[model samples]
Target chain A: MSARDAVLGAVKAALGRSRPADPADPAAVAAEALALLADPDAVRPALPGTDAAVAFAARVVSPKVGATLDRVEALADLPGAVRRYLDGQGLPHLLALQPDPALQGLDWAGFELRDAALPDEAAAFGLARWGIAETGSLVFHSGPDTAVLGHFLPLHHIAAVRASTILPHLEDYAAVCGAAPRNANLITGASGTTDIEGSYVRGAHGPRFLHVLLVAD
Target chain B: MGTVFKRDVARALSDATLKTAIDRTTVTAERKRAAALTDYPQFAAARERGTRIKDHVVAHLDHYLLEFERNATASGATVHWAADSEEACRIVLGICRGAGARRVTRSKSMLGEEIGLPHALEAAGIERVETDLAEHIVQLAGETPSHIIWPALHKTREQVSALFKASHRDPHKTEDVEAMVESARRELRDRFLSAEVGISGANFLVADSGAVCTVTNEGNAELTTTPPRVHIVTAGIEKLVPSLAHAFVLLRLLVRSATGADLTQYTTFHCGPKRPGDLDGPQEFHIVLVDNGRSRMLADAGLREMLRCIRCGACMNHCVVYRQIGGHAYGATYPGPMGAVLTPALQGAEKARDLPHACTLNGRCQEVCPVGIPLPALLRGWRDRSWKDGLVPQSVRSGLWLWRFAAERPRLYHLGTAAAVRAMRLFRRGGWIGRMPLAGAWTRYRDFPAPAGRTFMEQLRDRERGR
Candidate 1:
């Protein structure tokens, strides 16, 4: 009678299922989905044996991702690393920081810090929820403190991740993120495009440079 | 569609620029894919897992689609079902109208092209801007995408620069790739910020979490889904996978096969709109599950494997014929070996009668297919069906019949072959035949090599007899 019914009917007839599943019983469907979600380890590939932090550092610095990695011995050392990276790249003094507790209480004297990402911000920094070693991806969950636009809208993106938060594989990252956040971005490297004659050009629509500061305690 | 295939192929072959463009791009893509796979040792295992997951999902598509609907609805998003392109367009337009959307920013979606969404929206007085760089070029040029992943692979830098200069207000544009990309970035940024609705195609629809995952290197998909108030993901029913883990398996294979990257720059999972504490994201999330002709594809057991396509474009990249003729010659939304079988299966065997015959039966497509779809067998099956349906041209049918008659008996076959070789010797000049009867098409391109005086059978028999 409805589009849904017609689609389901056609699918059922094609699949050779004589009768369709009961549409009224959504609980059963949800239960089945929950079962699938509960076991996220199935069909996972065997990852490399490198420790999460080491793998994360190695993968990010690889030519494929082309992301610069900075290691900090403690959270207190983050500002120094960020300052050194900014000075090394000869970037501007101003940077937009995500409104997160981890990024707060940092001694940023010379830099003009803003809470929101401006359209033309030279660099924007955010705290990653987790680091995926397999793909050198930073897992950022969308929340009040972590703005989604700051990750892409800026010319340069700087992310800080705790060494302990790094995981070996995407499956592990998925389990950590739970069912779903509003947005879960696994940003691996600087934004790029091969759209023009298949030439690899970085910073097509997103940040040109991605520098990750891996804070270890 | 029938006449356009040959004409398009002819034009593509003659265009040296197009040939160079395709040859360079496809060679680079193939090399990258090979190198990426070598770096990832688990590619074979992951591909197997991906195949198993897709097979399971397609087998139980009805169940998974329902599960996805329930979960997505529970996550504060609306799910709409469209049995055909008309319904899909109607639902999308209705949603846009309901939300009072005028300017829509769309990420590159093959499904959007399949359903003619842009034309539909334009007809309803909505301005649709394509955000992908290649897609933007094709959009400005008023052309359908030639390749799925790299839509403007057929366009040279000069052509793209010309298109930008003609379309954009920038008078100082150069033919440099980065400058053109920057120009597009600057122009589309305003559209992304100001669009009322964002439309995208999902790489995978996670059934458990009701998340629509889109993979992109340009981050357009992320921007397309982020800023707009209404984010609509239009995906075919076959885009569904059981869970996030399954999605990762396919994701690994997809990037490696498509662009030879270890992983795309951005693989974002949008669960629903924005969550309770989210600062910025779309407030409304909707998914339109489009069937179009997939139900018919599923109805036939032999054709059901077409639904397993991840649209990685590997088949076309590796296809010799596709490399020679390019994608426009296929005269369909999809092209190449996959398109040859899929186009006929989706849009009747009769309509695309010439498509299945365009293949050289190289089996390269199937060899490189990540899903291991026996594409050559499928194309051959389509050819058989076309012949049975009387779609083959009369000349071809009569030629095949003549060959069949001669081949039925070995004695007659040898006799006919000997006679043909004798006749070829008479017409031979410079070790080649300038013209042949009923094969003007073959002779028009290059001289056919004259057959040896004796057939292979006769030579083999004499050699065995120690002559």
Candidate 2:
């Protein structure tokens, strides 16, 4: 038997069945599993947040959030916010930007822009498709526009997400993240680890700094 | 069997470093767990939902496993199945050889450890570097992971600093934690950027969309999978949830129960190799699902609940036996109450009979268990099986037999206990027995209370006579 057959057959045997789909009086195991997939709305925890944007902003900028945030009135205002955040953190304004359309049509007179973030690059910019409020997570979908390296390679990651795209919870993103994203990253905060004897370290492997730009428009 | 474990634990008990490290992590984790649950009152409900989802998936694993394979293939990823650990190692080795991978970068994987993947790689002449900070420390020290979450937290800071200085060959080394972390980051960055293959363990597999999800606080997993030419995910068949929604529900329970965090710093899902025009991701994506005795576990209804483990390390953090002796004493891939039950089921009740007997049946592990595994009951079940299989120690078996013989005879039991109570008084020193013959092990650490002059049965009889 194929390894798949042998393995699944083992399960079938465990469940007291001879095959995946049997015509026994009891419901076939395959059919029962398919029935579960039909219903996507599983039980969700009762988190206290009715308004998505408010909860998201509060969480992203919370005192112990390990990340910084800036709320821009429009998508066009994101450049100014990023500039201000860079200036505030004493980081260089030069950034390797993901070649995304959502990032175009912006005035970039002062800042030097480059392609996908280099391994030792100080900062990188990317656009997020969705933001989750419950944990203040940014959902990055890899495609022609978004460079997966921009999410990890740089020391600082500036992710921009529209406030209107902020979902109240992670389960809500499942409905929005339909079949398009072959690769999706739900980053809750900056890369960190308490592995060294429970002492918190901000940058363990990836970006040490995660700054989220909430585009109000 | 008892002699081996007794030796291992005897060494662990005397190791001052191990005791200090265990006390720190367990106490901090328990405190954080309480605080996180307090902030989020819905944790109880989320845990219940997570357990129910796992139960449903385990019951119908055959369908979901096939569904995961089909959907993953549809997304341009290859899915391989392994009936056991050897086949799983061979498949991973074959992938690396086919890719001509000289060097590989890896995130921490419990399944990888279970299958002895590191040894396989070493034997096949492939060099692999562990990217997780804790895992990297353990690798340099040439030891298996003790704790699941804090893989190498058992080592002291001085030990970690020394390990780095020796491994990295740095002359200007200090005992500072931050400097050590920076050293690892700098040392591993080139490997992450250069490795041909990156192997990671899946935290959960979404059967609905075939997303191999990995949850980690460190960004090592992200960097490991992103820059490599090939990304191979090694996961157990039991790590499946029905959909992304169900996954989030479990994610809620996992983070809080593990480290008292609201969520993991990073939870990435890879649906396929890469999208049409992705700039930088693995060109090839493959997921190897290993059975490795999980089928045997599923077949046994009594031991089936062991499969619900999310490996958050909560049970170990709160276990009475684990706190006393720590993970290395368990002498298995997994440790603590979960390991106590799972190790025997996977290895055999006879080989690891000492495991089930290690538990004090305190029930603290199950109380803190995110998926609500009845650990005390499971430990009891293993003990019962050990007794039936004659794997229990001869002394314990005979002692129980003697108790049962007396317990069955009420008059003789009263007479025997009355005489035993009088004998116990001989060793009495003031309020407690400092020493007792043939039972010195009982008072080895703690004084045994002096028995009353008469057995309770005799006193009860006198009271009934209205004396």
Candidate 3:
């Protein structure tokens, strides 16, 4: 018999093999997928459509991290507002940054530096080239060679995004890039999950807290 | 004689504790998969799209792969191609040696497992720790993964708690899932910080950028590949796609089809090494493109489409038989309908001789395959080849021969059925047979309805004659 006949025979035999199939409703499946993606508590909810999907991904995958830094002096002397903001949130262990060139000498801890990997335990709040201003997310790439540990392994993941970097809508990103990236990452706030149960735990796979620095600068 | 393959096969088939672990985990995973698929939309769309994109990528693979390599090299990542698993392992191990890596953290990748990475790395004196929650459980248990998606799906909460207590010394101080995760995390975090190298698997290799994609519900995949100065990726050649746009399409389909998730918690992309102004990332990047048996598969027109599979477990979850026997019974790293077809083709018929016969040919796997693989047809091909090559047992051969003979002639078929019916009636009563010698197992679990005795033809004849 021809391949067509063989396929038909197989289908017939398969139909005989199982009980009646539950109907397949495609629209319901798509709606459900959109709902999951939009759900904040979802563990990487499926982004709806090709546009939302790509934008959400670009935020997580192609973050505009590693450009430049405006260091503000002593850890304590740094912006009181920034420190107090964090302190009110119950976060400590922040360090001081000085752009004196002598102290900010090495490429390792430089502000807005590109092509550097995140140190294994280091916390970084770098800027993403593109972001969802509404959600205050930083877009960047996470791979073995990119901000490897800084993306997820860090105790604190703070991403600084320029307000100008923010897209009015997620759809505008694809037009901005022209074509989709091979792999894009969109990170909104911090990485959190409740996979242990429905108990809503933070930081199962990513940073426990996501602090977004929406810098007007 | 003492190869890892032999040992793995033996361990997979006979290890009672591991078998139990795989069985329970696979069932739960299959259930979750069902729940996930049932609850999600775009599932069918994702499956269709996944099938189309993978097919497109594989169709123009040579162009896309070259393009990827060019872009990847441009971005400062070195790409290596391995003809087989050994070569891939050697390339990765050499990278470790060159980097002076004493310890390594691993994210779960079946490709790495397929190549027997841990064993090879250990031989090179590199300490490797599996950091994925499920992988950590399996590693601590010293077992291989049963389900591709949920590697530790076999373990129950109570079992994990017990394992946690026995495995860790400071268990009393922390007694919850968070604590258990924290302990594993804290321990692995130290390894990530100290290790000079990170090893991982790629979900999709973009041909346009020469980038490797790793999708995870957990962050360990990112941590394992990053942080270390030297990063190595061991991936199957079939994973390559044309571009990042295509990558998204596949990713969209993968999670939705595999676990019914819109997206995994972490979907990260790595282009190459750290750029000039980068703060953290590997100093170097190496990708090992493993052919193993895939190139051979591509040549076989019938089996070529199998390469398009994205390793989603949708088919396995929908399979009635797979749900019952679980993955261990399939006796390979890949289990279920996909495993039945892939193992024999990749490993050879003699090595995986039992796989083809193990299936009931239900074809449910084909219905749900994201890549539209004709699984049953391929399985049937394996069966025919096995028999033609004299791989079939003598008893099975004789039985088939008898069946073929009876099936060829309607008269002989009737004679056979009449005789069988008479024999069944002598032992059957109350529309049920309590037991039959060779068929005892069937009756043990279920009541066998008695045969109608009179052939349909005989009844037709009687009615016409008005006897």
| Maximum-TM-score candidate | 1
State which docking tier applies to candidate 3: incorrect
What's the lDDT for residue B398 in model 3?
95
Give per-model CA RMSD: 2.5, 2.6, 10.9
Off by more than 4 A, model 1:
A22-49, B171-174, B425-435, B446-450
lDDT of 3 by residue, B23-65 (tens): 5544554555566666555556555656766665555444445
The clash number for model 2 is: 0
| Candidate 2 lDDT | 0.85
User: Runs in model 3 with CA error above 4 Å?
Assistant: A1-128, A131-138, A141-148, A155-184, A188-202, A209-217, B1-46, B172-176, B425-434, B440-467
Candidate number with greatest DockQ: 1
Error of 3 at B191 (Å): 1.0
**Candidate 1 at B460: error in angstroms?**
0.9
The per-prediction i-RMS, to one decimal, reads 2.8, 2.6, 10.7
DockQ-sorted candidate list, best first: 1, 2, 3
Question: What's model 3's lDDT at B56?
Answer: 55
TM-score of model 3 vs. true structure: 0.75
Model 1: interface root-mean-square deviation in Å: 2.8
